[model samples]
Target chain A: MRVFITDTTLRKGMQSASLELTYEKRKELFFLLSSTGIHELEVGVPAHSEEERDYIKYLARSQHGDKVIVWNRANIRDVEASLECSVKKLEIAIPVSDFMIKEKLNKDRDYIVRLLKEIIPYVKSKKLYLSVGFEDVSRADREFVIKLLECIREEGADRVRLSDTVGVLNPLQTNELVKTASSFLDVEVHFHNDFGMATANSITAFLSGAKYINASLLGLGERCGITPLEEVVFYLQLIQGVHTGINVKRLYEIVNYFIDMTNIHLAPNKPLIGKNAFTNKSSIHIDGLTKSKRTYLPFDPEVVGSKAALAFGLYSEKANKLCKK
Target chain B: MRVFITDTTLRKGMQSASLELTYEKRKELFFLLSSTGIHELEVGVPAHSEEERDYIKYLARSQHGDKVIVWNRANIRDVEASLECSVKKLEIAIPVSDFMIKEKLNKDRDYIVRLLKEIIPYVKSKKLYLSVGFEDVSRADREFVIKLLECIREEGADRVRLSDTVGVLNPLQTNELVKTASSFLDVEVHFHNDFGMATANSITAFLSGAKYINASLLGLGERCGITPLEEVVFYLQLIQGVHTGINVKRLYEIVNYFIDMTNIHLAPNKPLIGKNAFTNKSSIHIDGLTKSKRTYLPFDPEVVGSKAALAFGLYSEKANKLCKK
Candidate 1:
């Protein structure tokens, strides 16, 4: 099945300390990301700042307006801010776990149900595609999560986002979570890479029937970041046979441009877009690549606008081969 | 169930072009890794160089000899080299995929079975714990892989390593592969991270009853590297309830030390050991941390000898809170 993507490079990515993009730069980023034909872009949190609101207003009225999704808190002010931007799609996030409800909001489950009762229909009345995001749902009581899903679905919410806010869910757990969440409403998954399982969990969530997968340009977000957009897209195309309409070849260019704009240097060994992702050093691996690219390379580097190279080093057998010749 | 780990930091890690650890540095890394109580260390490929052979001899005769496993190719010369090191344990790697067997080795399946028949008994006769590594097994024909497993088991091979040399298998496929392999002999899993799924695949392999999981520090290896040792160790302890007897607290320190010794700087968002793994900048997340750390953290950062901190940025609400106070 085809999967939809909601890349949050402009929202969750900007929330991290490392990246700080101005409105003009963010506008540039929007076009670059949009060029990939991503299904949606969580453009910005309208309530975050006047500049954020202005940017949301610009994107909400742009040619790609249908592809822009404004993020909001489960409050009237946040809703009003997005409404002012004339955004056609929005996600209202609320803490779902009991610990978060009590500590962060000083409320109970009844309060959440009441908040959803008001927010879900209010957004629906405005004819916006509303997604009720369950923040920290991975740690929420399973029965309560189901109850919340029913609550939102009953109130006309179009989707429910299973946010692994703390990055605690493994693939197996994600499968069960998505399976349960999808039975009620369209499912979107947002994961943190805290334990380095976000890519895996996102893929599992999709296989288990998640419709929308939330990711970022380079998995750039809170703490260890989120699922990487390039990873999910390439994986689906090459391995799962699920073709996302995204332009796979533009991935490296987009990620490189983002890195250049943000001055974030990825680890050379970072998967997919890293400098060394396709570079082979060992003689054994080089030999394998010499015979058949499939022997050492996962997918052709050209699929993502990259190329493979061999670096002669401590393990180079090229010298021996040349000597024999 | 307690899971087993065979870290290949000095072997596969060193094989990469970026890292060139001298024998002395490897000795230092050995002690650092050994202190974590890792089940085994694939120290190095003894047949690669004279220095490698000497280092293998030193480790094979040391106090941690039983914990060391020398790597070899599926050749008598490689086996004899390991024997000269007096290594009590060794793994003979042979290409198993049709493409690799045909192109890399210019041999067929029958040749593989023949090689295993001769080599398995030869290694077994030496009273060494032998693991038959099926390189590129992820792309091998399923029936042929099973047939080879039967051949190795009949020849008295103690373990079979399912090596995802091209990093193609996802978690579900890994589960099925490991489940099938474990029935014939003890199972070890080694995966590359080309698709950014090795950590997930390795964890799934363990959950599917594979006894041994191979990893490298920082996931360092060929191409985009292998499954990371830290990710697997932390994931099992915090998420899966599989307590590997590893000192989790030493993870950051060890990674930092390795980085200094190798001059490799990881992405700040690198999970577990990156500079920003526990740093929160977003106002909402910092507020959550203020109320309760669990609201924003996957696990206590101190578990990995790190601490959480708040950095004021574009999204900081701390300024408003302080003004109200």
Candidate 2:
């Protein structure tokens, strides 16, 4: 599977919970995730804190296996901070929609385009991989998004990340957007789970020709976090027949470690790594699942380093009783 | 604006982690939810236990305002049990796809039709409001769904429920399915949160043409639960201008009570009632939000008895300093 894992534990996951990590802790996490085979580490915005910038620089110098990506606004100051940290990849996030830009940034589409054109060359001068992020791209005018992609490509950006900033796009919209954007440039998908369409949207983007996806461990990020890495990895490899290059056996270990380090509880219903993702409760479902897993399961739980659990409650007899039989 | 609330706490919420309520507890919850202005309540399956049958019958007799719905399989035995329990509304659930019917039931399409035709009349004979649930309808062939809807409608089913049984639908698919089904009959949507598309799918279903939706408190159910009642209520009222006789200000109380009673930890990122749903984590976001609540919030959190939270981590200094401010 040609898969890429982006660890958002430092960014989105921490924001989702009540916990806060120091600069040293973030550096530790970046090193750990990089060593654990994650392809990308979304280190927090370098402009946000001098300490964070120093930590990103430390990790960039120390960790050699994975790309260190620093998130920033479409501003020269943010771009310069990221470059000073020696990060290989910089994500310049510019809100594309009139609603977001007008309301959030008090800027118009013309200003957005100008901002991207200005930042792209500055990052390229530092020899950093530039991934232009179109914030709230789903709500953005389709023509605007297409134009943004073209401008980013023309400006020599390595890739463009289509962000469903508010998590509004469904799979069909995701497919349409990604397909249109992919025609002009290498597309990446960054989905939030606000309305819980993140993973599905990401998969649809992949199917529509996006080469990279922005995901957090356990779908962690602001709001509902980003698309879950584990879920996207599973779907890409098992269902869509895509190559994600994920070490499936180590997925659970990574989840547990992140959970332990962050103290954020995974939603029981979270796909792949959630407590009950593979658990069967109904007697009928358990019976069929036990007879043959395909009767109830979409993908083998073992493929993601999870075991099917048959728990007893309102729906079925005790799993131990079934085992005894 | 016209809206309705259907609480599936008994049917779907029971599927949450380690949640097993006695017959009396279910009845108590029914009364509590009914008193809180829920228009409908999905009581447990009468086919499961004699106590369930007695409790459902008692609740149906006593709870005069709320529509008491008993969930059942499209089988003679299940329908008979629902009738015996005195449920006024019968939700007859049946597999609609060739994959589900053949793999799960080991039955052909002809057999399923025969079974539904046989049971629908018996259900209608009791003067019960019948809603046929097409399980996994998203994966089912559209032609098959249309045929089954026609058959059930002719047999006196009051409405049709399109179930995304495995939560495999995206918003586009949900809109398409609901729109297609609406062309034939009044449609209700029952979405699972399996792939994290439940809320978006529910919204799209509402936008497309669905009049009713199945929801559980806190989005609790087997594999990620159904669409969350709070989210649907909020979105319909705030965004879509639809009113659901729900006392929106009391939503948090009901959600918290259910969570505490069940001992299930609510994910901070859960929509509507989640801790982070109204939180502003980014500093820039906080600045815009302070300028105008509309800058960051899609809808007022107070509409659902929630206040915006300012949390810290990756996004901004203003968000981190909200508590201090």
In order of listing, the candidates' clash counts read 0, 13
Candidate 1 lDDT, tens digit per residue, A199-283?
Answer: 9899999989999999998998988899999899989987778978888888668888788878896888888888888888888
RMSD of each: 1.7, 3.4
lDDT tens digits, residue span B1-325, model 1: 8888999998899766567778899888988998888889999887888988898888878887789998899999999989899888989999999889998989888999999999999999999999999999988999999999999999999899999998888887888999999999999999999888899898889988898999999999888899999999988887777978888877668878888888886898899888888888788887788788877888788777779876666777773474467
Error of 1 at A123 (Å): 0.9
Per-residue accuracy of model 2 over B64-109 as CA lDDT, tens digit each: 5247888898888888888787667889888888887887788899
What DockQ results do all the predictions give, each relative to the true complex? 0.76, 0.37
What is the lDDT, from 0 to 100, of the residue A181 in candidate 1? 92
lDDT of 1 at A272: 84
TM-score of each model, paired residue for residue: 0.97, 0.88
